[model samples]
Target: MLPLCSCAVIQSHPTVSMLVTHGPVRCGEVRRAVTTTSSPGDKSRQRLRSVRAGAALTMLTPLCTLVYVATTWSAGNRPAMAMICVSMLVLAAVALAGAQAIERAGRRATVQMAGLVVNIAGFTALALLDGGLKSAVGAYLPFLVIMLAVGMPLRPFLAVAGLAVAGYWTVAIIGGPAQMSYAVIHTIHTGIIATLCLRYSAAMVSLQRRLSDLSRIDPLTGCLNRRGFEERLANELAEAERTGDSAVLLLVDLDGFKEINDRYGHQAGDDLLVWTGRTIDEQLRTHDAVGRVGGDEFAAVLSGIEPDGVPVVLERLHAALDGVASAGIGYACYPAEATSPEALKEIADRRVYRDKVDHNRQVPAEAAVAGARGDGARRQSAKVSRHERRRRAITETGRLGISTPGMGLLYVLLFAGGHPNRWLMATLLTVAVTLGVTTVAAAARLSRSSAAAMIMPIVGALQFTICTVVVCLDGGASSTPALGMLTTLPLIALISPRAVLLPFAASAFVAIAVFVGVSSTWYAIGHLTSALVVSLVCASRGRVAAEQRRKLRELSRVDALTQCLNRRGFMERSTAELAHAHRHRRDLSLLILDLDRFKEVNDSEGHAAGDELLCWVGATLRERLHPHDVVGRLGGDEFVVLLSSHSAGETDDVAGDLEAALAERIGVSVGAGVLGRHGTDLEGLYAHADAELYRRKLARGRGRSRRPAAPADGNALVA
Candidate 1:
C-alpha cells in the first residue's frame, strides 16, 4: 500500500501547530503559504519520479507473479492466477502511461488510490482462487502493506494494513483448523511488519518536514532566509504577472549596523537583526513576504500593490523604523519600475544606497537642532570591554587546547603501552595531564583575550617540546613521533597572529637544522620540508583572510562618493582625538560646515553636478587642512572637520580661511566649537558646532547680516 501522494501534510504535524499565531508572519506562515500555493519544481520532479518508480514496481511485481504461476502451478490453477497477474499488469501499465497527465490534472492521489484498490482485489482473488490462506499468493499481502506504509497518509495506511491482515486471516480461517495455527503465525508476522513500516514512514515524513523548515528559515530571526525569499518572490511575481496585478519589491539596509556591532557586541547585533526582521514583517501585509537577504539587510515583496500606493507604504515603513536606528529604504514596482525580480532588486538596491546617503546628511543636521532644543541625542552603548573579549577567547581556546592533550594522554597510555621508553612515555603522560589541568585553571582565571592568545601558543610550544624530546629519545626525527610535531603548527597558526608566524617558523627551522645535524635521514628531510610547506600555506591563508577583513572594515568606514570618512568613521576618529586632547591637554576644535543653498545646485544643475561639487569640496578641504586633521562628509550637504592641536584662535582663523576659500567658488557657511568652551566629548562638540551652523544658515536665509561678530570667547565664530 504505497502512499497515494508524497506531498507534505502540514496540518498533520502537531509541531507546526505549536507555532505562535499572533506575531508578524514568520517562517511558519511563509512555508505554509508556499507549500500550499506553489508547485515547487523540486517537489514536482520528485513526484514524477515517485510515480514512475511506483509504476515500475507495480508492473514488475505482477509480471514476476505471472511467471511464477506459469512455472509452479497446475494448468487449472495457472489460468486463474495468470488472469489475476495480467489484470494487475494492465493496471500498472495504464498508471505508468498516465503518470504525467495525472500529475498535471492534480488527480494523482485519486488514481493512486484506485490502483491500490485494484491491486488488493487482484491479490485477494489470487490467494482465494489458488489455495486460500496457505497459498504463496498470501505472502504478497504483506508486501502490499510495506508499499502502502511508505508514503501513504497514516489513517489510510492503517486502513490498508488492517484490511490486508483481515483478508489473510479470513482466508486462513476458511482453510480449517489445520491451517489455523499457520494462519495465526502468519497474521502476527504481517501485523508486526506493518506496524514497524508505519512507524518508520511517519518518522521519515516528520524528518522531511523538519528539514524543509530548517532550509527556508533564518534561525535567529524566524524569517525566511535568502533561498526561501527568492523562491517565494519568484512565485509571487509569476502570479502577479498572470493576474495582471502589481507588486512592490523593497530593499532595506540598517544604517550604522557595523558601528552597533562594534560598540555593543555580536549578541546585541544579532538581537537588532532579529528586531529588524520583525519590524519589517509588522509593516507588511500578511500575504507579503519579508526575508533577511544580507547582514543588516532585509527584503520584502508586497503583492497587489499599485505604483501610486508605494509612496504611502514607504512613508509608513520609514515612520515605524525612524523610532529605532535610521534605515535606508528603496522600492521598485513590478511592471512599472522593473518587470523582473532581479531588475526590481537592482533598482531597489540603488535607491537604498541613495537613501542612505541622503539619510546620513540629514540626520546630523536634524540631531544638532534637536539637541539645541534640550532633546538629548541617543547615547551609544559602551564598547565591549577588552577584558570580556579576552576571557571569551581564552575559554574558547581552552576547549580545544585541553581536549587535545587529554586525548593524546589517553592515546599514549592505550596504544604505546609496549614502547621501550617507559619512563619517557610516563613523563609525556604526566606533562600532558599537567598541561590540561593548568590550561583549564588558567582559562578560568583569565579575563583577557590576549592572555588566552599567549597561553595557547605557549601550550602548543610545550606540547611540541615534549613530543620532540620523545622523538629524540625513541628514534630521532624519522620516528613516528615526528608527525606529532606537525599538529603544533596548526595550533600555532590558530592562536598566533601574523607577526608570530615568521619568528616561530624561523625558530622551528633552526631547531630542525640541529636535529638534522644529529641524524640526517630522508624521512627527516621530508618531514622538515612538509612542516615548512604547511607553515607557508597557513601563513598565506592567514594573510589573505586578514587583508579581506581590513578591506571590509575600511569599506564600512569610508564614504563611497567623497572617499572621506563616513559618519561612523568620523565619530570613531573624532572620539580618539577628543580622548587625546583630554589626556595631553592639547587644543582641539570642531567645525560644522553646510553648503549654503545646496539644494539650488541640484535643482539648477542636476544631481551629478551637485555630486561633482561635493567631491570637489572634499578634495579642497583635504588640501587646505593639515595632514593630521580629519575631514568627513556626514551625509547630504553637511561636512565636519576636526582641527587637531588647534587653539580656539587658530581654529577660528582656519574656519574663516576655509569659508573664504569655499565661498570663492560656492556659497558656504562655517561654525566652530572650541575645546573647553563648547563641551568635552565628541557629541557635545558636534551639537554646539551644528547649532552655530544652523543659526548662520537661518541668518543667511532671512536677508540679515551675513557675518556676525565673534562671540565673547572669540572661539565661537560664524563665517
Candidate 2:
C-alpha cells in the first residue's frame, strides 16, 4: 500500500518527474511547479536555511559520538571510532558548502545525497562497534538513519533507509551471537517507521498543492481567479503570437441578474453562477480560459480561434445559458485587430463598452426588464434573510451582545430585601437575562434597519429602570443595588450606543434624584464615577465596533468605485419596495440606464476618466432622485433605479429628466418599466426595462445608418 501510494503521487506531479527518468537521487524542478504554501523563490530561500541548520547538526553529531565513546569505549571500537572521526570531518565540511550550493537545484540534490552518505556511515559505525540491537549505542543508530528523511525527497529518503537496514542486519547477525530471528523482527520494525517518514514527505507536497489551488482558483466557481486568469491570458497571447493564429477575448456581463437575486433569493443566484461557470467551460476547448473577473461579470480568452469562430462559440454559450442569462459578448481578434495583447485587450474592452452603449441606444425608454441572478451576486442583504443577518452580526462581534444585561444580574442579588422588592428584582433580572439571550437569538432578524437596533436596547434599559425603582423603594441612592443600576446603564450602552443608552441613563439618574432627595448628593459621587468609567469604556467599544461594522457593510453592499449599492443591495431594497407596492396595489416603476459611448471615452481618454464618469453618474442620480429612490450599479456600465410610489407615467417622466440632465454631461439612454404594465415584481420590471433599453439602442443605430439625400436640390440646381 505504501509503495503504491508513493508511486501514485510521484506519477501525478510533474515536478517530481525526475525521480522516474533520472537516478532516484537527482533533484527535480519542484518549486512553483508544485502547489505549496510558499512560492518557488520562497521555497529556495527555505532550502538555504534548512541547509545551514543541517550543517550545524552534522557537526554536533560527531561531538555526541565522541561523548558516548569516552563513556563506554571497549577495545573492539578503535577501528569504528577512526571511521566515525573521518566521516564526521568530511560531513561537516560538505554541509558548510552545501548551504550555498543548495540554492542551485542540481547542487541541492547532490548535497542532500552527501548528507545521506554521512547518515549511513554514522549508523553503520554504531551497528558494527556496539553490541548489536541490544546495546544503547546500537539503539541510537535507527533514529539517526530516519532523521535524514526530513528534507530529502521520497526516493532519496527511502534509499538512505535501505542502507540503514542492510547495516543493521549485518551488525545484528555478526555481533548478536548469530540471532537471525531478532534481526528480522527489529529490521521489520525499523522499516515500518521509515515508511511513515517517506509518507510524511509526500503528504507535505500534497498540502502545498492545496494551498496553491486556494490562491489561484475561485472558491465559488472553480475558475481561475483574476490573477490566475491574467496569467493564463498572457500565456495564450504569447502562444498565438508565436503560432500565427488569433485569440478572442469576451467580457460577459450577465443581464438583469440582480432581479433574480431579489425575487428567488441568494442561493438561487449562487446556483446560477456555478451553472454559468460550467456552461462557459463546456463551450470552450480545454486550452481556453474563463474567469469570474468581478460580480456578475465573466471574462474569457479563446486562443488560436479566428474572428468567425468567435460567434459560433458565443452562440453555443447562449444556447447553454438559455434564457437564464443573456451574455453580452465583446471580442477582438489577434493579428486582425491588433498584434499586441494589451492593445487587443483594450480593443475588446472598448467593444464591450460599445455593445452596452449600442444596446442602450436601441432599446425603448419605457420598458422594465427582469434580470436573473448568478450565484456570485445572488444573496440578499441581512434585512431580507435571517441567516445572513445572524452571520454578519456574529462575524463582526463574535457574540450576541451578551453583556447587555450583565450588570442587571448583580442588581438582582444586591436588592434582595422585602418580599415585594425581592419579587420585583427577580422579575427584572429574569426578563433582563431572557431578553439578553433573545437579543442574540434575534440577530438573524436584526440589521441596519432602525427598528432592529432598538429592540434589545429598549428592553434592556426598561429592565434596568424597573430594578432601579425597586432599589430606591428599599433604601434609595444610598443602597448598593440602586448604585448598581448606574453600572447597568453602561452595559446597555455597550450593546447599543448614544441613541438608546444616554436617554435611558439620564431618565434613571433623574428618578434617583426625585426619590433619594438632596441628602443623597454626596452618594451620587460613586454612582457618577461608576457611570463615567463604564460609560466611557462601553462607548469607546461601541464606536470602534460601529466603525468596523460600517466598513464591513460597505465592503459587502457598496460598489468600490462608484460608491453606490451593488447588485445585491439594490436588488434587496428594490424587492422589498416592489412587494410593498404589490400588497397596496399601488403603481411602481423601475428605470434602467446605460451611458452612451462610455467605451469610446474610456478608450480615448483612459480608465480614470471612465471611473470619474461612473462616479459622477452615481452622484448625479442620487442628487436628482427622491429620497426613497433606490439606485444601484449592476456591474460594468449598467445602472438601475427603483422608484417607490411612482406610477408608470411618473417613472417615465423622471427617467426622461435624468436623460436630459445627463445629456449635457454624458451620453445617456434610459428605459422605464411600470409595475402594473410590466411584470409586478423586481424580476418582471427589470426584464421589461432592459428590453426597452435594448430596443431604443437598436432604433438609434438604424436611424444613424440611414443618411438623408442632402445634395439633390443644391447639386441639381447648380448643374
Candidate 3:
C-alpha cells in the first residue's frame, strides 16, 4: 500500500499552515507579503517565470516516465507494473491539463498543488512496484522537491517536503522491512536540496529588491523620478475618477534658468535645482506628489482637492517661488479642464508657455536647449574600463570552472559505491584533481593581471576539451560526465568574449559530435540541440546582467540632481587622474567654486527653485568644460573641478571665463592651485586653493562665506 491509503487528501488553503496555497496567482501580491526591497511587479514576474518553468517540466516528467515504462516491461511483476504504468499515464494526463491551466492565466496555484499531489502519488507507486527505498526511482523524489522549492513559497514547500519524506517511509515499510541506511541517506539528500533551495530563494529576493530601487526611485531629489511620478499620477487619477473627486496638475518651468546656468557654472545651477525640488516638496501635502519631469521643468499632482480650495494652494505655491527664478506656473483641474493625464499635461504646458510669454517679452527669443548631452559625455571614459569588464566576465566563468574537479570527484566516489571501475575511477579522479588545481592557478593569474583576460578563451577551450575526454572515457553522452558538457558548454558561451565565442561554440559542437561513437547517436544529437538552446539563453542573460551592472555603477557615481560626480565619485576619479598626471609629469590644477549668497536664495524662492538653479549650474560647467575635466559637488554650494594638464596661466584664464559666465545672476568666487607650484599632493593643493578662495572672499568683503571650506586634511583625496 502507498501513502495514498491515508484517505486524508491534503486540502489546499490560502494560509501558511496549509499544505498548499490555492488562489488566483496575484503577480506582485506574494512579493509584497514579504518585506522585499524589490517592487511587486519585478518579483511577480520572476515568480511567474519560475512557475511556468516548473509547471512545464512537471508536466513532461510523468509523460517521460510512462514512455520509459511502456518500452521496458518485465514479465515477473506484470500485474503490479502494469497498474503503476496505468497510473503514470493518468498522472501525465492530469499534469498536461494543469500545465495548460497555468499557462492560460499565468500561474494557477490550485493546479500547481494538484500537480504536486499527482507527482508524489505516482513516484510513490513506482517505488513500491520497483524496490521501495532501494529503487533508483525513489532518488528522483529530491528532484521534485527541488522544483517545488524554486516555484513555491518556503512554507508550502516545506509541507511538500514533509509529505515526500512520509511517502518514502510509508512505501519502504509496505514493501517490507525498511532499510535504515537507505532511509537516512535519502532523507539527508532531500534535506540538503531543501537547504540549497532556501538559500537561493533568499538571495534572489534580496537582489530583486535592489534592482527595484534602482529602477524606480529618483537619485537626485529624493523624490519620485519621472517614471515613478507617472505611475503615481495614473493611480491618483484613477482614484479621482472612481471617487468623483477632483485632481489638480501643475507644471512649473524655471524662467531665465539658462541665463543663470550660463553665468554661474553648473554647480550653482545644480544647487538652485536641488533647492527648488526640496522647497516645492515641502510646500505640498504629504500625499501630494512632485517630480522633475524635464531639464528645467517640474510637475506636481494634488489629489482630492476641491476647485474652490485650489486658489489657496496656488497662493502658497506662488509665494514659495517668488524671486526664485521667475517660474512660469500653469495648472489644469482634472474632470474640469481635461479628463486624461495626457490632456491635463498638455493644457498645463500650454498655459505655462503662455504665462512665460506674458511675464517676459524675451520669451519669444529664448529657445529650449537641444539634445542636452548627459553626464556620461562629461567623463573621459567609463568608471570600469573595458579591460576590467572583460576580466570580470571571465572571472565568473573561472569561479564556476574551479568547482568542476570537486563535482568530478563526487561523481567518482558515487560510481565506486556500485560499479567495477576502480582503475577508471582513479584515473578520472587524478585527471579531475590535476585540472582543478590548474584552473585555480589560472584564475588567480587572471585576477592579478589585466592582460590575462585574453587568455581566458584558451582556458575555456581546455575546459571543454577535458569534458570531451571525460565523456569518451566514461562511456559517451549517456554517461554522468556527459551531462557536465551540457552545463559547462552553455556557461562558456555566456562568459566568453564575443571574439572567442564563435570558435569556442564551433569546437564545443565538434566535441558533441564525438559523443555519437561512445554513446547513442540520438542522445548525442539531443545533447547538441539542448546545449545550443541553453547556451543561447544563458548568453543573453549574461549580457543583460552585464549591462545592468554597468548602469547601476554609473548611477552610484553620478550626483542625482546635477549629474556631476558626487563627492565620492570625484575623489575616486580625481585620485586616478591625479596619479596619471603625476606619472606623465603633466600640469594639473584644482579649482573650488563657492556660490555667493546661495543660502539666501534657498530661503526666499524655496529649495525646489534653488535645486533648479543648481542643476543649471552643473549643466553650465559640464557644457563649458572639456570632457577630460572633472566636475564634482563636494557637499553644499561648493563645486570642485580638476583640470588635468592645465598650466597656471591657462587655469587662471578658465577661471576668468567662469566668473564672467556666472556674474549676471549670481556671483562666484574662484580659488586656484597648481600641482608642484602650490603643493605636491591633492590635500596640499586643496589647502592652497582654499587659502586663495578665502583671500578673494575677504577682498570682496564677504567675510568668509557662511559655509566653511572643506579642510585640506591628509584624506582629502580619499573616497
Winning candidate number (TM-score): 3
lDDT of 1 by residue, 103-210 (tens): 778877776666667766777777777666435454456545544443357887776677667776767777666656445544543444344435533543343344
Candidate 3 lDDT, tens digit per residue, 315-334?
Answer: 78777766554577788998
- Residues 92-129 of candidate 2 have per-residue lDDT tens digits of 66666656765675465566566656656665665576
Models ranked on TM-score: 3, 1, 2
Which of 2 and 3 is ahead in TM-score?
3
Candidate 3 ranges with C-alpha deviation above 4 Å: 1-399, 409-448, 489-518, 645-649, 705-719
Whose lDDT is greatest here? Answer: 1
Give the backbone clash total of model 3.
Answer: 40
lDDT of 1 at 385: 32
> Candidate 1 or 3, higher lDDT?
1
Model 1 per-residue lDDT at 365: 31
The local distance difference test score of each candidate is: 0.59, 0.54, 0.57
Let me know the TM-score candidate 3 reaches against the reference structure.
0.55
lDDT of 2 at 373: 28
Question: On a 0 to 100 scale, what is the lDDT of residue 220 in model 2?
Answer: 49
